[model samples]
Target: MKKIFGLLLVVLAVFAIASCVSEPAPKKDSPLDATVAYPPKILEHKGTAWGANPPAWLMEALKGYKFVERMADYQGKIVVIVEQDGESREGAELAASRLDAIPRISTLMGLRVKDTFAGAQVGDKDKIETYMERVVKVASETRFSGFMMEDSWWTYLQTYTPEGKADKRTYRVIQLWTMSKAALEKQLDSILKGEAANEPKTPEKERAIQAVQNAFYEGF
Candidate 1:
């Protein structure tokens, strides 16, 4: 009977120990968890230069306009340059109003004014050209109607030197543009079929035609 009581006491002690012991707390997902997937690719492009070939007449019209640095299209919409400064802003507003008044252009696609900083220092001429090309390519690929330029300055520790002084530099100016994918596809179709009857046959004409085609297909 004593042995039985001892065994019962031992079992109760084991039960008590098990009850007192706690299971490990559930692990929480970290705020910077890598398990989360990246967002889906968006149809948009951005750059420092224009991508689409504007009509010859439009090009001539834009001449002598220093504020109008670059222009391009997002789908059917005309993306115009908008200098964020007071003078440029006023001009952009006037242009926008006038564009809204135009039946032919406005009816087809509305205008989009993209703000830019004039005094930005972007490397040498070659680098600037390359940057513009990249922007235009991105704009075409992404099918974005408008983009804005943002200047960013930052200071970082110069660890290369023994003193490790704080160094400041203009990190970069980022341009981001986005447009509706559906709108871009629709405009591309219209552009491809608009003048099919009088399609250019000359090499220059063919190249021009190819440029628009590539904007839709190759996105550059």
Candidate 2:
């Protein structure tokens, strides 16, 4: 049977601001490392994630965060989850990092969606059931471009005290746009009608197309 409907797909990878751990206070013979705190301060903080009220800060911090699937209100386009690369250097510079991130992430994302979506027709429309394989290609042809930011959180290999520091950098969740259900269905319909796919496959098309397929059943 020909399955037709709208759907949103996403890839969820947890990331956090990078931090590292430190050693105890310095010994008489060895000085403490500059990156590590000379003296450590411990906290008595004890908290549970559930069964109780969450702090105001936690609530506030998560206020704008939403799964890409929930943001259909922004536009009819399908949402593709992507990871925005964040760089950690000698200093913290969000502005510059974001600039570098756009193109870098876009290139990596292109490799993912280069093929878009595809569909195959099987059985006759009069048959009780039908099977099909489908492929949908967008960005290269329809100018599928641009992306939105999604929720981001910290990730750590191991837990640490408050002052712990690590070499990891902050990572972000990127919301990439693809064709909407109506739009994707239209692609399949065109295929069924024996019509040509989207035209003028652009030489530069990656930022938009790669995401939808990997996250979706036929998107790869």
lDDT of each: 0.29, 0.30
TM-score of 1: 0.22
Candidate 1 residue runs with Cα over 4 Å from true position: 1-82, 87-177, 200-215
TM-score of 2: 0.29
Find the number of clashing residue pairs for candidate 2. 21
Q: What digit string (tens of lDDT, one per residue) describes model 1 on residues 123-159?
A: 2323233333333333333333332221211111111
lDDT of 1 at 178: 32
Error of 2 at 126 (Å): 20
1-220, model 2: which lDDT tens digit per residue? 0000000011111121113334334334435543433221211111212223322322322322223334535345444433332343212224323553455444433433333322212222122111112222222233223444433322112222434533333322232333455654454344423322332233222212223222333443
- What TM-score against the true fold does each predicted structure earn? 0.22, 0.29
lDDT for residue 147 in candidate 2, whole number 0-100: 46
Q: Who wins the TM-score comparison?
A: 2
